[model samples]
Target: MQLNKQNLTAFAGKLPCPDYDRGHLQTGIVHIGVGGFHRSHQAYYVHQLLKDGTPEWGITGVGLREGDRAMAEVLQAQDGLYTLVNQRPNGTNSSEIIGSIRDYLLAPDNPDAVIQRMAHPKTKIVSLTITEGGYNLNAATEEFDLTNPDVQYEIAHPQEPRTVFGYLAAALRKRKAGGHPAFTVLSCDNIQHNGNVARRMLLAFARHQDPELAGWIEKEVTFPNSMVDRITPVTTPEVSEYLFREFELEDGWPVVCEPFIQWVVEDNFVNGRPPLETVGVQFVPDVSPYEKMKIRLLNAGHSVLGIPGALHGHPTIDACMRDKVFAGFMRAFMDQEVTPILDPVAGIDLEAYKDQLEARFANPNIRDGVGRICSESSAKLPKFLQPTLRENLRRGGEIHRATFILAAWCYYSDQRHNEKNEPLEILDERAAQLHRAAAGTTTDPISFLRQESIFGDLSEQPRFVEAYTEAVRLVYDRGDVRSLMADW
Candidate 1:
């Protein structure tokens, strides 16, 4: 079946399909960033709600960047319908035609069209999955960087806004003037306290653009913190070909993910929300414990596990999990270095959670890109490792494994090439600067850790500095990633 609205009925019997009248779906969620993660997780959840007769929660997805045009076109052609393929390690696969997305608009094509969608009276929620860096925070200060070129341009030209925050502030202004209640701003990014980050940045942007609107937002809006998890790999052509060859499905952009999925949300939406709990979403009084646990444990654990594979030319995360040395080191490292600092999270067994992470990483059917974990190490290392580092330093915990990860990152940045001698695509804002610093300073690890943005003052501390220097020298000595776990 060529998966589009017309072919939907013919394909419905082949897979679990939306049972509701697709025409009856109302657009309530104006989601910004219709990426793989959002489609496989949030949109999938909304699809379940619609199937169970939940009203007015169908998503009107918005794409903000020029790169999103391709996705926008695909969703438009398919009538906001696509397939989600779950590939499990247990030798089982499942496919479903998801129809929760009611519409999509490319904001770069027409900014006002998206602003108007956000201002719509029926829109009760405006969500985002615009990645961690998209928040535009000053890495050190954690405040909205008003001086960013795009931020400056958007502030100057409010009507033709370029940034997400600019569009949001403008939309709220319009909605308030029209006597409409503010929509809940839900952030699905993997940022720590993502809701708080969104609220802070949006309010800051609005205060600079219009102080009155900022006040209105501070008094009227609700930004709920959430913890969302799913191992959705980036979409590739091979995925589509596999779907067609296996089941005669021709989905232009089918999202492929692991079978595991979870969402823990704070029940604090200003405008009413759908009964998400009906579909297994855990609505909690506080999401901090869950958020911290996941970010430090699973999210941070990704880099801890996958980066070594990346350095060694391993194609996928499963390869890293299958490697006996890498897998063993991670199991011991987490037990010793990562888990001790965590405060008790409600209803979570840390030991069992660690076990599940190992199992999830070993899911060979889910070919999650090693590059995905290694992609933004510059930004991610600070976010993921600093908490553990700081706590370990404070409480006299061992940081040997943590420091090795740092050295591994520094090594990867310098040796940003694979076994084939092709340049590895490094996706980081500080890539050139880090490489230049590390050009010949492998023995003197201080040159790399002197990057105050990444390492802060930890480079000056004797224990961490010694550990980092030893690890870097040992690994760089042999130029082998497997040497990371060796006693340096």
Candidate 2:
């Protein structure tokens, strides 16, 4: 049978779907960005409440961008019922039907509906999984871009909002005028200090509309920073086909992810929240230690190898992991460079965490695309890789390997052909500008580094300048990543 709420009992009897009654779920949370990550991670935990026969908190997912239209339709068709496949490297897999999302609002189609859903008293938390660049942060200053065109439009047209920032600020304003309590704003994106970043950007947008409302948000609303981990790839037709052929269940948009998942959140909320600790969530007084560990090791580790992996003509992270040189570079990059900067996380054995991360990256079943990791290199490198670069400079540490990462990305920007001389895709919005900056790499080695927004003061730092110059020279001379690794 096709996946939908109407088939709940019958499907559960035939397949391993949710065992609890579907009618008991009530919308207590409104999650923005109904992407693969949100479904596989946050919604999975909320769905667990139903499986445990305590279905109080269902989710109302809001689609804020153009890419979300198809997702909105799929969930709306299925009554928010979709399959989740947890594939492991050890060749074992399991499937479950997650039933936490009760409704969806494609904001572009119906803006008022999105605002009303968020403004509703029962929607205690508004969570977001929009990617790093979606926050509209200024690349150079790392501050909220108040002058962004969308933000500007929202400032003027408060009632008719466009961006997520606008919708959130407007909805909160409505709740305040109605004398309803403020709801907590939660960020589930992989950005560094995600909660604080959300609070900063949200208030900035709100202040533009009404300064009083912004101040109220600053004082009343709780933005809990969280660290969420799950290797969820974009759902391809292959996944849907697999489900239909294997299980005789045709889920329109099933999420395929690795078996592992983790969420570490701050215990700060204006209204009540789910008992997330019941599902292995670490609710801590401070999320910094945990956040730093994840941002550096996992996110940073991805950046450390992303471009080099792509340049090696590898399609997925598992392929990169299978290459001895790529695998060696990751281990050295993590253990020697990233581990030194990270503080001792509470209850975490850093060594074991590093080993587990390596295993997860090498998981062949997940098939996370290297091209996907290379997509927002401009935004990601600054947040994920540059911190390590900056810290290594501050502490007078070796920067040869980190310097190679920068060079690899610059080279990757100019590469439109594979080793076989066939056309290859460079999947970045900034591809044109980056290729322009990478013009004459051998003759003008520092041109790419001169991008102030990306490299900032690193161009002026003597230590990095010397290391980067050498690294770029070495990669260009050998013309192969394998040789570069061998020399290192």
Candidate 3:
């Protein structure tokens, strides 16, 4: 049977389906960027709330880019219903049909409709999962980039907004003029202080358009920082095919993920918020310590294995974790390098959390792609790994493994193929610059480290330079990542 409202009751005995009335659901949230992460994480949470009888918190997902058109079509065709499959480490699967997404709007097709939806009084929250780079932050200055052509276009033509910031400014301005309360802007991205970052970027864009409107948003709006965690991989055709073969269900866009899911949100919504805390969501007074611990450990751990794993021909994170050498290296990096820099996260056992991370990475069924983890390294490394590296360097702590990871990244950037002759896909935004700098590592050993925007004077540090240069030589000259990791 096809996955939709009509076929909901048909799958009742086969798997978990929404037990509530779908027609009574109302849209209280307008989420921008309806990607796999949003579907599996935030949408899933709202689905749980609906299942528990809170029908006022349905989601209206918005897609700003043309790439989101496919998702729009799939969700609309399925009546905004899709299966959420949780693949367990023990090779078992638990699937549920999430029904919190009541509608989807492709913003590129109808930007006015999206702005109007956000401007509506019922949209108490406008959330985002627009990745790390979507905030339009400058890597060097750590501020909103007004020089971007898209941003400039939005600034010039505010009525027909293009970027997320443009859409937000337009919507919030309408809300203010119409005598409606401004909604909370919740950011569910992986960045530390994600809400603060969102607020700063949106206010910057709004101020550029109109100073008075920016002042209203500054005083009236609240952006709640949230830390969301889930191992949702990019959807492959195999996922839908698996659903068809096993459960006799046809879902054009089903989400598949590991059984682990977490969302730590700050309890600071301005408009009336949903009872999300009752549905396994942790409402915290402060989210800093939690975000710091998660980013430095889990996010950094992915990079710890990603570059070397890709170079060594490991196809997935689980593949790298299966190898004793790779596993030991990652463990050592976490315990010796990252753990010391972390503050005491309230109510969380650090050692147990590390163990859980290892288990999560080793889940064979998840098949988390190494290339996916390695993609956008230029953006990811600055937030996830570089902070740990800087802290270790300042405190005279263990920097060998972290430095070697950077060397592996440079080696990976310079190479065309892994050890197994599989093509190494360079997916970073600064791929060209990375390749150019890495190519000069043979003659000038510190070329890659000289990227001031990324490394920030780390090339001048003799200790870091010595370790990174030796690591580059070991990996590039010998072409033996396994031996280098094993010896380290």
Candidate 4:
């Protein structure tokens, strides 16, 4: 049987949304980067909102990339319907037919359709999950790369666009021209101060196009900070088949994640907003503290463990968690390198927080890929890993562990040496630079850190450079992460 909109009805028996009222659901939100994470995390949350009440927050997913046509086709056939399975080690808890996604627009295939939706006055929130690298930024300069041909073309032809920032800026220009107030630009990426980054990119695009329009957005728009956490893994063939058999039907984009989910958002919206607070979303004065702990601890933890585990022949996060040495290394690294710098947010217990992370990683049913977490390391490290490194060094703390992290990062980016001694695939913007750097020993850690764009001004720190250099030599010479880590 072909999986389509109606096939979702088969799942109703397994997980019910009896109270869900689709008629009341309004298209109030527009989401960019409607990938697996958004479907599993943000889309699931909004689905809960509709299932309980407040159907006014349904999402219209926008695929920013040209090649995202397959996703568009799948969602369109299903009427934006999909399943969300919360997997635990013991069992599974599934949601039947998440109907929060009302529509989808593949921007390359249907640019006009996307623009029309963006221009709608009813759409009050423009949220994003364009990933760390999708922002089309020069990580070193912390600015939009207008030099990017995609961005340049969008700038040249404002009537049509390609990049996320371009599409957003063009839509805002339409809204401004029509005398419609700008909707809030809510960023849900893993980066720190993501809202500010989004605003900066958008403003940069706008200023280049029209100075007055940039000022207008600065006055009318609100970019609210948010902290979103959920362990959503990429769907595998085995997992997908399991879900299909378990549900008694097919689901093309089922989101399998850990049972735990959280969203801490600032209450800032233009036109209107969702009653997300009703659905357990914490509406706080500031999401900064929560953001800090999540980015520094959980996100950084993933990056820290990613390459080490991958090279150690562990394919899944759970497998890595079960490794006694790796597990302790993570805990100790967090305790020594990351945690002290975290100012407790809203009485959050630092010790208990660490305990929860252990449990989250140990969820056996959730098969998070090291490669997935490991993607875009160059972009992710600046936000997720660099802060902790800087804080520890500033206080004259041990950086040997953090330096090993950088070395592992260098090795991973080099993307070589599978267990079979074959080449591991590299997927990043700076593959060539990394490949060149990886050929010889990165004995001088400063050489890697000196990439001012990624490390910012931190490369100039004498102590940090020393620690990084020492760690690099240790890893290169020893050629064993576990042994080097154990000694540390």
Candidate 5:
């Protein structure tokens, strides 16, 4: 049976299907960037609320880029229904069909339609999962990049908006003009204080277009900070094949993830919000401690293993964890360097959270790729790893393992291949610049650290420079990351 609204009855006996009638569902939320993580995390949470008889929070997904056309095709063909498979550490599988997404619109195809949907009075919340770099903030100034060509175009022609900020500013302007109340802007990205970042970027863009409109948004709108956690990998053809072979369900783009999921959100909204708190969503007064803890530990832990593990030719995170030396290095980096910098997260046991992260990484069934974790290091390291290094430098803490990881990244960027000589696909936006810096490592020794946008004067710090120089020398001279990690 195919996965669609019509086939829910067919999948009922085999897997968990939506129990409510989706036809009567209304759209109260407009979510941008409908990727695997959105489907598995935010969409999944909304699906739970739908199952509990709250039909007002159905989502209308918007895809801004041309790459999102593929997802648009899949979800539209499936009648906004898709299968979500949870791979457990114990080798068991659980699957469910999520039905909260009522419609999808590719913005490049019809930008006006997308804006009008958000301007509608019923759409109370506009959410985003547009990745860390999607906000278009300048790295040094941490302000919206008004110099971007697309942003300039959007500012010149707001009616034909091409970016998220453009569309948001246009829609909010319409809402204010039509005497409609402003909707809450919720950001579910992994960045610390994501809501604040979103608000700043959007306001910068809005002010560039119209100062009066920007003031209205600042006074009326609320960007609720949120921390969303899930281990959803890219949906490969093998995943679709597995769904077909095991459950006889032909899904074009089914999402697969680990069995762990979490969402901690600030309880602040302008218009009415969903009863998400009743569905395992923690609605707290402050989300800073929770966001800080997750980013420093789980996200940084991935980088600690991913950079060296990729150089050592580990295919997946589980493969790295299978090696005792890599596993020990991961734990040591967290306990010695990261844990000390974190503030006390209310009601969370730090040690137990660390244990849970280890178990999640070691789950063989998840097959979370090392390349995926290492792809966008330029953007990720600034947020995830560098903060810990900055804090450690101030307090004089252990920086050996963290410094070595940076060395491993330089070598990885320079070589672009594993020990086995197989090419590692470098996917960062700054790949060319990274390779250029890494090429000068032999002569300068700290050339890679000189990328001021990334390192931000850390190269000039004596302690960091000493540790980095030693680590880079070892990486090149010995040519064995596993042995270096074991000895460290």
Candidate 6:
């Protein structure tokens, strides 16, 4: 009774089989950054379409690096088969072996193959899940850095390129030459107006390399904004074991995620797309409001909690949330700090949204990484914290809490005092400067707080600068994250 693809068809009581042949499903989408989240989220939706006899939207996944090649190898050996395990605190559910990924492209192995596929008349959508840092962008300008060695290599040799922007620009050039209709470049990353960010980088890269191609892209491409959400972690043996025992399949690359999922997409397509609305994908006129809500609220909330929680020696989000102090910190950060400035989406209840966030954070089964949230703090801070800080400062509201959060970040990045006594693995571009600014044990700690890139022009404002200075001083001297503020 082992649940291989054959027996897994009806594994879910609610999930039914397609009336047609899933193997006949052909590739219509070329997905970039085919990692765990893309596999668990977008691929899961496509698999649902397959189960309902929609075969036109199968994916040809493209991996940008050697690590991706290993993932591709696993899926290819399993015959493009994998399982998705969805769990909640109370129970679990599983998907049959997914076959929606028709093929994978290793950029180094066959860049031509990927280029040809992207240039294909039938490939309607090009989706991306490359993390924020992968954009290789200038943190201040939000533009691609042509000076980056990867970008320089991609520029010099257009063929057999490695960067996402390079591959995308090359593929679009092919389509433009082929007289093929342009594809929609849907961004599935968590960045704000990610479609715009992707467009800015790609077009900027193209303009630097070839101005004509940039013009063609402006005329032909549809970079639609999207907001995607899910909580899927890196796959581990415990997850593989869960899939094997529950589904009775030995999937080499299984994706386990929380039960919650959301995708709000712009209703524009060039070559055509799946009936994904039938599978709960919301096609909307705009995704900005939704994007802001998720980014400022959900993602910012995670960033707010992640460092403090990690420094306190909490292993997972749930474990951190279980501590009364952490829970209260989340509430105050959301209610007192983040919510006041947020304009609620049309149907969203701010209170209920807060409640759901708390519930999601408390889901013990979903072990989201502290490090994952901590990466690219230089890029992330402006988007996540600076906005709220500006709004609060404009109103002369107290931002002591937000300031303390920044102090925590500086300390964490400083790494001189991690409980393990190991140095912090800071990944920021401004690390050396920030380290020098923070040098010497002093009670008047605005030296580090004066980082203009992170604090922005707002650091010039006397009130905001004073508050940040005092907050850093208090936290460093007290040596207790909670004691930095007596209220919480």
Best by lDDT: 5
lDDT of 3 at 414: 84
TM-score, candidate 1, is 0.96
Error of 5 at 330 (Å): 0.8
Runs off by more than 4 Å, candidate 1: 419-422, 440-444, 486-488
Error in Å for residue 336 of model 3: 0.9
Model 4 C-alpha lDDT per residue in residues 159-264, reported as the tens digit of each score: 7788887788878888998989888999999978888888888889888877888999999999988999999988777766876676666777777788888999
Give lDDT tens digits, candidate 3, residues 83-200: 9989999998888889999999999888899999999999999999988888898765688898999999988988989899999999999999999999999999889999999999
Candidate 1 vs 4: which has more lDDT: 1
Best by TM-score: 5
Report how far residue 101 has shifted in candidate 2, in Å.
0.8
Whole-model lDDT, candidate 6? Answer: 0.77
Q: Number of backbone collisions per candidate, in order?
A: 0, 0, 0, 2, 0, 0
Query: Clash pairs of candidate 5?
Result: none
lDDT of each: 0.86, 0.85, 0.91, 0.79, 0.92, 0.77
Work out the TM-score per prediction.
0.96, 0.97, 0.97, 0.95, 0.98, 0.90
Looking at candidate 1, the ten consecutive residues that score lowest on lDDT are: 479-488
lDDT of 6 at 120: 89
Error of 1 at 191 (Å): 1.5
Q: Which tens-of-lDDT digit does each residue in 1-488 have in candidate 6?
A: 34334654555453433345756877789998888899889988888888787677889999888778788787666656677777787755655456788778888788888888988888989999988777776655555777888888888888757888888888888888888889989888888788888888888889887899999888788788889888887677988787556555566777878888999988877667788899999999988888888887788888778777656666678876887788788788888988877775877888998899899988887877676666667778777777778789999775767777887877776654555554555666666776776764274466665666456576577887787777666667665675443354
As a TM-score, model 4 comes out at 0.95
Q: Give the higher-lDDT candidate: 2 or 6.
A: 2
Superior by lDDT: candidate 1 or candidate 3: 3
lDDT of 5 by residue, 61-129 (tens): 999999899999999999999999899988877889899999999998899999999999999999998
Residue 8 in model 3: lDDT:
86
By summed lDDT, the worst window of 10 consecutive residues in model 6 runs over: 11-20
Model 2, 21-119: lDDT tens digits are 677777789999888899999999888766776566789999988778999989999998889989889877788888889889899898999999899
